[model samples]
Target: YRELLLRQRINEAAQAVMVAYAMGGDLDQLAANYNVKRLTVTPADNDAVPPVAAVMESDEALRLRVPAAFEGLSVAGPTAAYEFH
Candidate 1:
């Protein structure tokens, strides 16, 4: 997938999370849709474009770059919910 397309997907995911959060959905439920785990440090990698965070990459490799800009998040939103760790 193209980098622009992947970023779009990541943005979509982030938006969904916000929606779910607004609806008071538990983190697990939202995470489930996003492949997030419980209590574990899940990579917020949103820089998933073209062979980076691809659905085909090995799990370990994807997890390693979770903290990246595209993966983690570079921009702040109107109601930005993410915080630096």
Candidate 2:
């Protein structure tokens, strides 16, 4: 049991470091490297059923956005800049 618990914790820690699997603060930190910040959702005041009170970008979405940000740095072309990375 102890060994299994240790392995689980290790797996969690490992995933936290990877953008493909990281969540919350870990994902936030990774996004920061690209100068990207997660967007927040604003609930409608008059709607009968508003969206979640605190909706933040999902890890999957943020992961996609981080790479796209690299495209913006290009003076020549996105493809060229992207290929440099």
Candidate 2: segments with Cα more than 4 A from true spot: 43-54, 79-85
lDDT of each: 0.43, 0.79
Q: For residues 1-85, what per-residue lDDT tens digits would candidate 2 score against the true structure? A: 9999999999999998888888889999988988888876554355447543666767787887777777767888767466534
**CA error at residue 54 for candidate 2, angstroms:** 4.7
lDDT of 2: 0.79
Q: Model 1: per-residue lDDT, tens digit, 1-85?
A: 6999999888766765552222224333544454543333444457655323323333343333333323334355422224322
Model 1: how far residue 51 lies from native, Å: 48
Q: Any runs in candidate 1 off by more than 4 Å, and if so which?
A: 20-85
